[model samples]
Target: MIQKKAYRFLLFLILQSCTQAQTFNKAKLDSFFVALNKNDQSMGNIAISANGVLVYQNAIGFSQINKGAKTPATIDTKYRVGSITKMFTAVMIFQLIDEGKLSFETPLARYFPQLPNASKINIREMLDHRSGLHNFTSDSLYSTYMGSLSLKLK
Candidate 1:
């Protein structure tokens, strides 16, 4: 088993090293974002990275609008994200379980013992939204605490 794991790791490293460096067209990206901002078509940040190197980053549109006042978005702007976080959490948890680092039957208490009835909540239940967890995000102050962010890399 150990030898097989090592062999796979070596193969992965070899393949990674064999890949060629990628180039991006920064002018095209800038033009596209400029068009989007000019036409009021989209608002958000975009970042492109290749081989662990940041190649391009740009932001467009307003971050907030209140009382007819607008705040322009920047590359570091924060946005509110609601239930979409559940999708990322689910995918990461599934990956851990698939890699044998976690199990569906693992109790939430293993990591969050302070949570209400955590011992009774399992990974599967949490992923399925059946854990009976409280939805604190519905509170009015949730947005005031921390805003959400979106990121994509290619």
Candidate 2:
């Protein structure tokens, strides 16, 4: 009888632990939003995931700082990720390279030999930002580009 009771108690404890985890995490998210709203600085978006589950997220601020256009921000917003996305992309590229499916020094000429100077470009140079290929977005005229490129591609 004691062993059966202990088993039930253990099950109860496990359920209780799970409930408490969810409750506490929710409270933490609330506090985070409170802080984000309390700040006077330009609002920013936050991406958070736990157990690979993205629970709550929000974005607060004008889309364009100069124009004060209150563009509604969402998780789907595609702003330049800066260098962070590069690390992930580079890791995948290198993994393929290591698998012998690709090489860092592979020239563009291997795939498209028609382009002049294609042999001068290599995968390694592209990953290291030595490709010298101009970032079209870097042009001053490209400023204020807010729409996502992903959607267009899709």
Best by lDDT: 1
lDDT by candidate, in order shown = 0.75, 0.64
CA shift of 87, model 2, Å: 2.1
* TM-score, model 2 to reference: 0.55
lDDT of 1 by residue, 37-117 (tens): 786667888776676977678889998888999888899887767589999998999899999999999999999999999
- For model 1 the local lDDT of residue 82 reads 56
TM-score of every model versus the real structure: 0.63, 0.55
Q: What is the lDDT of residue 146 in candidate 2?
A: 34
Model 1: how far residue 32 lies from native, Å:
1.6
Q: Tell me each candidate's RMSD, in Å, in order.
A: 11.9, 11.9
